[model samples]
Target chain A: MPALIEAKNVTKIFGGGLLDKSRTVALKDFSFQIDSDNPSVTSIVGESGSGKTTLARMLLGLAAPTEGEVLYNGKNLEKLGGSDRRQFLRDVQVIFQDPFEVYNPFYRIDHVLETPIKNFKLADTEKGRRDLMIESLEAVGIRPEEILGRFPHELSGGQRQRIMVARALLLRPKLIIADEPVSMVDASLRATILGSLLRLNREFGISLIYITHDLTTAFQVSEDIMVLYRGSLAEAGDVDQVVRHPEHPYTRLLVGSIPLPDPDLPWEGERAIGRPAGELGVQGDEYCQFHDRCPYAMPMCVQTHPPLFHTHPNRVTSCYLYRESPELPMPQMTSIFKSSNREGPPEETEQLDALDAELEVSQENSSTPTSADD
Target chain B: MVEETLSAEEPTAAELKETLKVEDLHVYFHTAAGAVKAVNGVSFSLKSGERFGLVGESGSGKSTIALSLLRLIKPPGKIEGGHVFLNGTDLVTLTEEQMRRKRLDEIALVAQGAMNSLNPVRRIRDQFILAYKDHDIDVKRSGLEERIGDLLTRVGLNREVANMFPHELSGGMKQRVCIALAISLSPSVIIADEPTSALDVVVQWQVMDTLRSVQEDLGASVILIGHDMGLMAQFVDRLGVMYAGKLVEIATVRDMFGDPLHPYGQMLIASLPSLESRKARLEGIPGITPSLLNPPSGCPFHTRCPKVMDHCSSVTPILQEVRPDHWVACHLYEEA
Candidate 1:
């Protein structure tokens, strides 16, 4: 069977138009397939400008890739015929990051829910439309009475987002692209939204493409996770294998950065602040994008970008360390748990007055004219 | 008025002098519909150099409390009753001019969405200069140019960034610049509202480290307001849990996370998906946040409290000491 959605060597370049000197490679030679037959959640996890949003847009057919094709059901998304295109549009839906912005403040709440029903012709009668709306809303744990005759301003952010989910559920979309759906929502309420998505995936067998920078939530919801670093694929594979045992140095950094809830498990060593973003959007194809920040980077990484190499049947990592024969000596790999922060008994440093006096002297020195030269 | 409102117990001579104290604050928004009690009778104290964390869902008055501290609450939303003390001096009695001077000099605020807080039209250096001037400091006489460079480097930015406008910096960079500006004067107290919520995890870590290091360098107390329980656990010395315009619990960070006394605090910690323990299901607190315009009668959390009782609707719960250094406002823990 043809995949529901597939990106074949997709690349997106922004601002390289006729008169523009600047060019940004949002996604570079990226490819992934969401199988149609088997419905499961696929997560594209990356930081800002890593091209997760661009990928979501391409999959939704909202934007065309600059260099490659996005295939829907084995047919190019751009080339789909009238009915096929409509079908494709109806099948793939998006849940945006901010719920407040997605909704129109002027309209009544039902307008958003009803528009999908009317456009898709899911129901003919008013009663039928109402019933469908109620059913969809109920599926997302919202009652009809709660949302009935309410304006967009009447609902909370979580409620507004749940309504969006319900509106998408009304379409019975085969695939849903949730781009940071829970990022705007509170942590206490995130479980409800995530739970709703998981239930839909299981009960209705809907394929979900969860795009987010949050790795922990991605681990919770996604079966297959793709970690992106500056538009290049860092690692891709089973979430358990990838997250539990992240292969890439960037992926390890990402895993280590997650703030664990345990107070007992404080950061082991001194936390290192990230280097300032150095010359974004202008890297040579051969140069590894993560070289500057990668602790395990070798001299070869500056000369050549490592292609995706299979570490196991279930995992692929783009790193020279995983290579069979590396010219440079491998940097010692630190265990994320131990190396994340130096392991020590939590310090009971009560001598702040003494420290403050020292800090005061240093502060005065730094402010002095002579200190600048020194 | 401050003395009358404060409970009978006096501060012991041995007790540490609080860097900032908020006592029984009530800030309401006088909207057309009705007065929305955004912050109702909330109180907490920050000892000098303590990093305090406030965690709650949106519309739970966390930001309002932060705003209330700075007296930044605009018209139609006013602090109805409160005593904000800095080293035992009441801020509520200060005039506009006095309050203005107190801001940035004594208590600095790194507001939420600080990237957007920078003036789009102004250069970074001008903003810093303007802030110093607003606090009645002559930037040129103080050699603020060199100080600005030092501040930028302290937050991991180049001195050259002072020439750039807000548009020139990345979100994370802009946030660091805001931190730099906040700490330029080395204020006694700093209130950072959702400082890292917008940044990526790695960048968030970096920003947090910068803030921590900056706080340590200045020996300044910090009140970090964010909803991420995990980040709060790692960052703060004490945790204040707010809900529906009131602080429902206050405890040390270790106690709050190790064994939360309040039901809301417990559910909040439980709802979060911990990397350490991937629990099969997260028991998210039920119901949406109550509308502050017409909140529940007795306890704000009673509407959704898992251990709610019939008496919960009639009697308001006061934050009482449930354990040594831990306070909870639930009726379940109320003393006879």
Candidate 2:
């Protein structure tokens, strides 16, 4: 079976003109595939400058890659004919981060739901369009009675986003590119919007490209995970395996930063590898992008960039530690000690223990507020 | 000698008295639609060095409360009735000039989207100087650069960052600058509303660390306002769950997370997706927060509360002490 979407050794470079001297590589020889028959969810997890957005834009055909090509059903997306382009658009849909921007303030929510239905001719009559709108709206947990004829300002952010989802559902696209869909929405309503996307994935067999920096939510929703670090692929594998045992140093940092909900399970040990300061993407292009911040940075890391090594059957990590042949006994976390000889494990543990034992009590607990002063 | 004499009596007063105390605070927005009760009879207190979290979804009036604390609520919105006692002085009754002086010196706000709070046109140093001059700080023109550099370094930024414009800095850097500025004056209370909401996770961790260290170093109370329950669990000392302009529950982070008493608080905690556990779907709180213009009679959350009783809809429940430090405003726990 042909893949639904495939990126073949794609690269995107920005700014190499008079206004800009240094070129920023948003994606470096990136390649990935989504099987059309299987149609599962894939999360492109990355930080702010991780080039996940660039990949999404390329996949949507909104932006072209500098090299390689994004293929849809074994056909190049850039080379698609007018008719094929229309079909491709119908097959693929995008849900943006901000819902407020999706709709106009002057128009009613009905305009959003109506456009897709009218353009696609998903329904024949006015009654059919109304029915389709209601069905799609209900699918995203929005009541047509409450939302119809209501302006964008009248509805909440979550409600507006659900309407966007409902609008997407009206097309019944084969794939949905949701770029931080729930990040802008409040936490309470986050699950509902995410649930709707999951429903579209499972129930409707729609493949989803869920892009977010939040690993926890990505792990919760996606089957496959792709971890990116400053335009470079760090690790990619099954969500369960990758989240449990992240191989890449950048992936480990991302996973370690996730704050757990349990108060007793305080964040301790294995701090995030801080981003190296001064001029991003200015480091040697041949060297490992994460070498500066990697806790286990080896001397060879500066000399050569590591290829994507298959650590497990499903897991792939682009790190020198998991190289095919031994370079230097997989550089231990000795670099930290080498940099700061005074600081050791004992002091770190002591600080962790003290922080863990810090009381949840406030100073006002022992004394009452001065309400009498009023 | 004079400074030593004044500082001698400050320790006991700081320890004994609350840094910020808000009692029966009510703020209403007089919109063309109607009177919107943003905050209604909400009372909470933060100690000198306490880290307090105000958690609620959009329209829960949590942000409104934060704004009301700093007296930043603009027109159309009026402070209806309340006593915001910052160091035993009722701020509601204070004159505009007195409040302006008291605003930055006594209580400062690191407003939500603080990255955008900085003027893009001006350099970071000029903004810091402008803020410093507003409160009439004694930093001379020559020494201001060094002072700005010190503040920038405290927030983990390089001294050269003070010379750059807000546009030159990334979102995280801008947020750190905002954090640095909020604590520059060494205010007694810092209301950081959604401080890390817009930043990346790793950046958020660093920004949070910066806030904690600065807050500790300055011995300032922090009112951290955000809807991220997981973040609050790791960051805050106390948690307050708000629903429809009322604080439904307030307790230590331990008790609130371990055993949430109120239904709203319980549901809020249960709804959070944990990173450790891979629960497929979250049991989200049902129904939207009611319209504040004409909120539901009595209990605002009764419309959505799973453990709703007949009397809950008709009678307003006052916040009562359940556990030693835990307070709940639900009728179900009234007898207990």
Off by over 4 Å in 1: A17-20, A268-283, A325-374, B1-14
Tens-digit lDDT track of model 1 for B1-336:
111223212122237777888878888889888788888788888888889999888778999989889999999999999789987779889998898988888899987796679999999999999988887787778677888999999998889999999999988889999999999888999999999888888888888888999999999999999898878988998899999888888888898988998888987886777554343354456665777777778888886676889989877787877787888888898766
Per-residue lDDT of candidate 2, residues A1-374 (tens digit) = 66677888888988785357687889878887765555577789999889999999999999899989999988999999988888899989999999979888888889988888888888899999999999887766666777798778876677778788888888988889999998888887787678777767756777788999888889877767888898988877777788988888778777777778877875642334355653234345687888878788877776767777766655677898888833321112111111112221111222122212211111111121111100
Interface RMSD of every candidate? Answer: 19.5, 14.2
The TM-score leader among the candidates is 1
Residue A176 of candidate 1: its Cα lDDT?
A: 93
* Candidate 1, A233-343: lDDT as tens digits: 888777778888888988888888777787777553224444344433324457778877776766688677787766665567788898873222111111111111233
Q: lDDT for model 2, on a 0 to 1 scale?
A: 0.77
lDDT of 1: 0.78
Off by over 4 Å in 2: A17-19, A268-284, A325-374, B1-16, B141-145
- lDDT by residue (B38-109, candidate 2, tens digit) is 888788888879999999887889999988887878999888886788999999998889999987688888
Question: Could you tell me which 10 consecutive residues in candidate 1 chain A have the lowest summed lDDT?
Answer: A330-339
